[model samples]
Target: MKFYNFMTSQDSSVQLVDQAVLLFTLGEEKEAESLLVEYLSRHENDLSAWRALSEIRLSTKDFSAAEHACRKALSINPDDLTSNVSLARILVSQGDKEGAEEASSKARVLGWKDELAQDEHNG
Candidate 1:
C-alpha cells in the first residue's frame, strides 16, 4: 500500500486538487486519481475531492467505483447538486431508471434552491 502523510492544510489541499485537475485535463488521469485519492484519504469531507474522484472514475469507465464515489459525495453533503447529477448519470447508464429519477430529482431541487439563493443575494 502507498503511504503518505495526510494532514495538509486546506489551502494546500485545494492547491493539490487544482494541480490534479490540470493533470486530468492534460489526459493524465492516473496521476490525477492518485492525487485525488491521496487528498480524500485525509480530507474526506472535501466536496471537490469527492466530486473529482467521481468524475475520474466515470471517465475511466469504472461504473461501480464512480457510483460509489458519487454516493460518498452525497453522504458528505446530501444536497450537493453535482454529486446528485453524477449519481443520476451513473444510474441511468446502469439501467436503474428509478434510482436515476431519484437522483435527478435531488439535483433539480438543489439547483432551484441554489438559483433562488443566488437571485436573492443579487437583489
Candidate 2:
C-alpha cells in the first residue's frame, strides 16, 4: 500500500494521477478509482496517467479496468515495453493464459532485440 514515489513531482500528469495514487496507497481503493475515472475524462491519451490508473486498478483486483487502460496505452505506442508487460499481467489476472503467454513472448523478443541494439551502440 505504499504510494508511488513520483506522485509528488509537479509534472503535467501529476495532478491527474497523484490523488488516486495517494488514496490507493492509503487503502481507499474505491475513492482512488473514482479519481482515476475523473482523470481519464480529460487525459484519456496520457500514457503516464493511464499507467498509474491501470496499476491502481490492478491493485484493487479490477482486471477489466486495468486491461482497458493497458490497451489505451498500447494504442498510444504499440511498442511500449511497459504497456506490453502490463497488458500481459492484466491478461494473467483475468485468467487469459494464452493471451498472457503471447504478450510475454512478444515482450521477450522485443527486449532481446533492444538489448542487442544497445550493445551494438555501446560497442
Candidate 3:
C-alpha cells in the first residue's frame, strides 16, 4: 500500500501507521501494536490510526482493547461506517449481542448514506 495515499495529514508522524501496518502484515504484532500506541499518543484524533489499532487488537483476540480503540475512532467520526462495523465486530466478539446489533444498524445506515452520496457524486 502507498503510505502517502493513506495519510490524511501532512504530519510526518502519520508515517508510523504505515510502518506499523507493514509490521503487522509481516506478523510482528507486538511491534506493530507498540508503534500504533506510540503514534496514537501524539495523534489521538486520527480516525484511521485508531481503526487500524482496533483491527490489530481484534486480530490478537484482545476484544476489550479492540472495542476501546474502535470506540475512540467512532468518537472522532460517528458517521464512519468502517468504525461502526468494527465496533459491531468487537461487541460481537465480547458477546454483547444487543450492542453489536446497534452498531451494525448504525453501520448500515452510514453505508447507505455513503452509497447515496457516491451515486449523487457520480450521477
Candidate 4:
C-alpha cells in the first residue's frame, strides 16, 4: 500500500495561523480557515490563536465554531470585540435577532463601534 504524506513542509501552527491571518485579511477567508483549523489542532486555548481560528470559522459560515471560539476568546478577555463580533454575527446569521441585538448593544457600549457599524450595515 502506498503511504500518504499528511505532514506539512512547515509544522509550526503559529506560522500557519499567521498565514491564515494574511489570507483572511486578503479576503480569502475560506482558505484561511482551512489553514487555521490545522493550527488549532496543535495549539488550543491561545487567545490570538483562537482569535484567528474564530475569524476563519466566522468567515466560512461555521457559526457554531465561531461562537465557541468567541467564547474562548472572551474567557481570555471579557471585552474582546474581534471575537464578540464574530459570535454576534453568527447569532445574527442564525436568526437569533435578540441575541445578535444584545451582542451588538454590548459591543457598542464596550467601545466596539466598528463592530456595531458593520452589524448594522449588514443587518
Best by TM-score: 3
lDDT of 3 by residue, 1-123 (tens): 655555456455557778888999999999999988987898899888898899999999999999999999989999989999999999999999999999999999999999999999999
Candidate 1 lDDT by residue in tens digits, 1-123: 998868668778678889988999999999999999987888888888888889988988888998988889889999888899999999998889999999899899999999999999999
Q: Where in model 3 is the C-alpha error above 4 Å?
A: 1-14
| Per-model TM-score versus the true fold | 0.87, 0.78, 0.89, 0.63
Candidate 1's TM-score reads 0.87
Q: Give the TM-score of candidate 4.
A: 0.63
lDDT of 3: 0.90
Highest lDDT, which number?
Answer: 3
Could you tell me the lDDT of residue 103 within candidate 3?
96
- 2 or 3, greater by lDDT: 3
Each candidate: RMSD to true structure?
5.5, 6.8, 5.0, 10.1
| Cα lDDT listed for each candidate | 0.89, 0.83, 0.90, 0.76
Rank order (by lDDT, best first): 3, 1, 2, 4
Question: How do these models rank on TM-score, best leading?
Answer: 3, 1, 2, 4
User: RMSD in Å for candidate 1, one decimal?
Assistant: 5.5
Candidate 3 is scored at a TM of 0.89
Q: Is candidate 2 or candidate 3 better by TM-score?
A: 3
Residue 96 C-alpha lDDT in model 3: 98
